[model samples]
Target: MRLTSLFFFFISIVVFPQKTIKTSFVKKTKLKAESIVSVTKSSNYTSLKYIDNQTLFLKLNDSIIYNYSNVQLGDITSFDAFSPLKIKLFYRDFNTVVVLDNRLAETDKVDFNVVKPYKNVSHVSTGFGNKLWVFNQDSQQLELYNYKTNQVSAKSLPIQSNLIDLKSSYSSCWLLTESYLYKYDSYGSLIYKIKNENYTTIALDYHDNILLKSANNLFYLTDYNQTIAPIEIPKLLIKQFLVTRGSLYIYDNEFLHEYQLIKD
Candidate 1:
């Protein structure tokens, strides 16, 4: 009985070990901006998506703002900065996607309605090498689409929950559903499924770090462990937030605040 108790204790420690290191946020800079719909950053510039009098604007580096007025494309559902040169704008209402160059020029457009197999795509993000990761609502699965060839290279099994949000990098993708958060590789294989834990928003960085937001608070799960740590931010009603390239940006009161996170 004593030996059995010791074995179980060891198993418990191994399964539920706690990490001591903590992550903290330090405010670095703030910039005044218009009502931002979404924001993304690259090494060279920051992209801000905003609206003005029924017209949408893509502001880069606070110096140039490009205007896009296409009523036929419907509302912008997703703004993805996959590459420094190519940005993806997804329109869910019309089942269309527009690729923009760094200057926000329309370089290409794809309407999924004309594609064979007829993917009712609800979410889209840039994928590895000339591919796009798209979530098909009708099929309840994620597919890797080759835009150049207009073919689905690979697909995942049907997911059970309703997908609420999705973010992706070059090599992997993260899906936030009504019940869980799922991580998948480029081949559409499920690597992990984490419980939702009341998180309303989610973002995944290139390093595979997971950032989750619940109401006004932010939490993150580092790449090294499963432990979730809270990220402190100044007292401001956060309208939206995102994590990119080891930095966190929060939008509140018509201003975007950038913070640098240090893990200690």
Candidate 2:
């Protein structure tokens, strides 16, 4: 049944791709900061990033601030906070994933190295229903793992390309590879595949529009069949970027800029 769903989605994507999404950029606000680590849109209308120090500092919604520090797990690889109630911190070097509450208090930890049926996890994202989306490097597959049960509930077929990025919502997840973009449903069905076109990273907006970025600038496929269009903005350093809730955020190490997405 899973394979059938996968094949169906592959054919569906070839016939009916993503809808056309036109965008107009309107500068909203720009703020400057120092000693930043990284940034991500953790919610529909909010942006979050940490600052450098022994401890991890987070500024959320541009108002509330929180700090979480842990030195035993090894350096933080990445984080996912799409949920209002939880945050996931992946320490890739240690093959561990830590879960935190909204208050930044540690609530759970998973050490894959010590866990039964050891999984060489490469990436992870928060999924709905107490589950986590994990990329099992040993199998080169995406797994919808029930972290609470320490079991794999669902998984995608073995991926043939190098994984670039993994972005997920409660219902779906998108895997970015070196040459293709794959979207899988909650059941791990491969629903879509698109060209990478040199885009190194990706962000899924609230509208499910795919935002793309290359080494030089940000771009998006206005329509699946149409060529990608550049997201025009003032020339500045682009260290990191994200799209959420009809907004595009670009942050350098020092300056953070927000642009309203005026979709046409």
Candidate 3:
């Protein structure tokens, strides 16, 4: 009788395997724009920047056009639109960052080589109160730099993993290493460290939602760390993707696809 009961229990477990319920919903919208190099969405408008050889073209909200070309800065290493009024353009090769106004005009410039201690910065992102979150490669740590004061206001403990990427918002900074992802608050306090699971890239929306890309698949992580796959993505293989606000942008075959994500 005991053997029969154990056999039935084993069968029930196989028949009633747990199911993973998706917690997020998304609606995809396709927009046709040609020869687009990059797209960034802000609270008010979307900025599309394109490059053709030595010349650069920028279209704001599908209407305005801005052109710029500079051989000295080389290719743009990072384009941060965290603040529409104060966009950040980092040239890693030159160890410089250019601040752009809402009109995409150069307003300020910072060269890390001139800073004391002569720190070598590899990554930079917008931060609150006229500051920037920069990754000092020489120290293998994150630093909150006050551009106005030209000082390092805060710094995190030295990270001990191979750095993959770094991203930041007004109030928080996230560093992704080979083994883990670290989140730091505005004061440089370590908030959380999550073990990575083969995530190649990550993006944080304005709402603090985390979106991750692994291989060709994109996944969204809920506050509880539930992995949810967006069901409405295009069938084409995603070459690259980014999340901003409530939208997911996918690039495939020279086409930029935009999807609006709705939380359920």
Candidate 4:
């Protein structure tokens, strides 16, 4: 009995020793940026937009201007500029989705109060193919709405669970429920479901990749169709991430970190 207890104690010490990683948290002031474009100048920083590579859209005194491109897109609200072109913006104030043109013109406006089949809309995502993925609170169903043609398509999802989070990129969507991540195509068809080991935060990266962050670890999921392989991020907890200007910008509470993706 004494030998068994000693052996167990030794095993526990070897197995569960405290593992520590040395990390230095520093506030990065100067970025390793090839080009720096200033988006906002004024103190309040009310309205700002970045479209494509060269254009910086700004709205001041009810006039919108494309700063770098030297073109005026005209008057649009801050929320209207949220979606921009090839994207959809879900305005929380009016419960409306505003669609814009290449020149930031109003293409279409989708009022959730009028068009939604269910009374409550829980979440909204903007996708390619001019579609809006809506999670309805009443039926607990996720549906795709074509604002361009004004058509609605339903998706098949599991029962009782609500859509906790949603993201869209290219022609795909990432829907997070209670325990799983459901990938849906542009037409709102369920393509695959990834069962997460723990509760995770999901975001859509450039080139249709998915960034899954569980606690402090960030995993880059390259191809979901093939075998899912997750590459761990070394030291930082990715608080937020965005794919902008063909680069992934990860925020870690203090500063923005950039990563260049290697295309195969």
Clashing pairs in 1: none
lDDT of 2 at 258: 74
Residue pairs clashing, model 4: none
Looking at candidate 2, the ten consecutive residues that score lowest on lDDT are 34-43
Question: Worst 10-residue stretch by lDDT in candidate 3?
Answer: 18-27
Root-mean-square deviation of Cα positions for candidate 2 versus the true structure, in angstroms? 7.0
- Top-TM-score candidate index: 1
Task: Compute each candidate's TM-score over C-alphas.
Answer: 0.83, 0.80, 0.79, 0.61
**Candidate 4, residues 135-246: lDDT per residue as tens digits?**
7666677777676676676565533665567776657778787777788787678778877656456665556777666676655565544234344334765655544433
Clash number by candidate, in order: 0, 0, 0, 0
lDDT of 2 at 173: 88
TM-score of 1: 0.83
lDDT of prediction 1: 0.77
Distance (Å) between predicted and true CA of 219, model 1? 0.7
Candidate 3 per-residue lDDT over residues 136-158, each given as its tens digit? 99999899999888888889999
Candidate 4 weakest lDDT stretch, 10 residues: 30-39
Task: List the global CA lDDT of all models.
Answer: 0.77, 0.76, 0.74, 0.55
- Tens digit of per-residue lDDT, candidate 1, span 1-264: 999999999898778754433444545445454445456766798677765544557777765467765677866777677574677878888999888776668888989999887889999998876789999999999999998899887899999988888888888888889898888898899888889988888766547887888878888887655567787667777777776677777778566677777666
Write candidate 2's Cα lDDT for 1-264 as tens digits.
999999998898778744444455545445554333334554365546553543556666767478887888767887777785677888999999888886788888988898788999999888996899999999999999887898887899999999999988898888999989888889999878887888787776664566788886877654345345667666778877776676777777665677776555
